[model samples]
Target: MIDNQLGIRKPRGLTAALSILTTYTPGGGRVPYEDEVGSDGLLRYKFQGNPQHYTNAGLRAAFREGVPLIWFFGIQQGVYLPFFPVWIVGVEAEQSQVAVALDEAQRSLPIGGVSSEIERRYSLGITRRRLHQPVFRQRVIQAYESACAMCRLRHRSLLDAAHIIPDRDTRGVPAIANGVSLCKIHHAAYDENILGIRPDYVVEVRADILREIDGPMLKHGLQELHHHALALPRRRADQPDPVLLEERYDRFRTAS
Candidate 1:
């Protein structure tokens, strides 16, 4: 809330584009400039179509003054994730795009560009860890239609995107095919190997858990899911990869 501005679409105190973040082509239409992020931990935001555009000037003002702004990154239709107080770290006038940084470490680097190879590499590593999982979760949840694969629960808040392969593994790319939508309980069970999914897309409960006498959660939530076919996405590409599923399932078998 800079300069008493009522909306985010305007400049704040003539210094910053007040929380400047824009989504393209969901409902309004395609944006003339396509923005992209580089592995260098910098987001190259496309310049405005008009050289004299007020917002472009506003962005320049923000860059000059080192003001903070919010970046509303759209992950899917009707869904946006807000990254607040991001810095206008650099302005590449020749390239017609500006560099934005997501973290303080990156923001503290050189004024015009990425500072050093070591610092940049570290920044990139942190940026990936910060951004990719949330985007991955959104994609996975969208594929599953916001329902849990095990219980078919449709509550959005209860849903989570569980990784088929752990992120530490080389093969654990943040893609829909490498993820599964589960409720919090099932997600915990999957992580603990208390429950597992076969490559065939069938659910399985651990032998000990299956035999144990417990509450309804233990019975219906875990046991009843045994032999149940995991709900899958309609699009084959968005469905979990069987090979990855098998890889993760192996761990579950071992742990169980």
Candidate 2:
């Protein structure tokens, strides 16, 4: 329940940690360093270089320990800078192997642009947990601009970014195209196979549910959603994946 000045509640501890790690490690990078316990009961990490270098190293240490760290970053006049807070998570020296492996993986990634090896490796490491609520919520909100994709509902707190492909099928995997922003009802409807989206971006109601005759409420709600397109993200990169939509809907269409 960590709240930022922007009014966005930190959805999970990992997200807070990732935000802190990325903020402290300028250019979204990480390194490895020594770990110590503080009198406050929080682990204290000693970074190996300047503040930025050490912050990155501490983040890697946190990840290796399977814990999340928190920090802050800011953008001023187009320049990005990070500041690491004193809070830390405790881990043993044996956990350092994970950090070493991450370091080696970062080095092997592509080395240029925002998509550089460091950024990619860091993002991958931070997002590898399926239950990481913050990343999942962020991806969902980003995909639909905090609005419901189906109903165009604008309540930020009520909308969820529903993953077309179940997260358990592949842990910690993220791509903007794999998500849909739906209100709780729509999200549940979607998950239970009651509602599906077509490749052409139309919504489909399952025939069995249509035949239920629960009332005008059900009939109107379900029918209105048919052939309606979803609200999409303003950024092209955040558009829903057509392939995933096709894969899910195509099979449903055949069976129905």
Candidate 3:
């Protein structure tokens, strides 16, 4: 809906995918351009924009309440070029609004400096990667608030945003409700199928593994987590989707 205010009209599929991605990484800048010929004989527009200018005020407000940056790109074409969406990556020169700069590498090459093909590739890759990173990390962190859901540990550096649903299954898009923040040890345990979380936010430890005669590793590492409630976000809106939690829990319960 906000896109409408900005006069950006994107295809449904592209918009849905971009929404999932921007929910994570949110500080990339964007540039608007009129069709101009580059030295390389290819028609490519330079990107220029200040990331700070493009940040959503509402989202920033959410960030103040502990929500992470969730930036997105909205493209509007001039008379000659068609409008399409692209993700903003790095800001150029740290400007406060959108700014444009020529691609030096593209300007140096033999084919008149610009590679139309490469530009297209860059457009898609930047958008995709930026979007995925935040969503994936935020979802996991939201569930546990960068603390280990199992052990209730709260070291930012030591915690990992773990995905309950694999990225591959979701086309590499990290949905917030599909993640949980865990410590490195716990993340590995969850990934390795040694531990799991229930839909009701309860911890689940593998019985056979816990009963093994190995050192107190299993007992101390996992059994201690049983019956513990997950560390949740301070704000209800920051919580991961209940449906996603249920789906992951169902699969994990069956496997256990």
Best by lDDT: 1
Better of 2 and 3 by lDDT: 2
Best by TM-score: 1
Global lDDT of each candidate: 0.74, 0.51, 0.47
Report the Cα lDDT for residue 163, model 2. 81
Pairs that collide in candidate 2 are 17-69, 20-71, 31-56, 31-57, 177-241
- Listing every candidate in turn, what is its Cα RMSD in Å to the true structure after a full C-alpha superposition? 5.5, 12.0, 14.0
Reference-based lDDT, residue 206, model 2: 84
lDDT of 2 by residue, 136-239 (tens): 46555754667888888888888887888776564213344677888888988888778889877788888877768677757776657877787777766567
Return the TM-score for each candidate structure.
0.71, 0.56, 0.50
Q: Best to worst by lDDT, what's the order? A: 1, 2, 3
List the candidate 1 regions with Cα displacement exceeding 4 Å.
Answer: 1-61, 92-97, 110-130
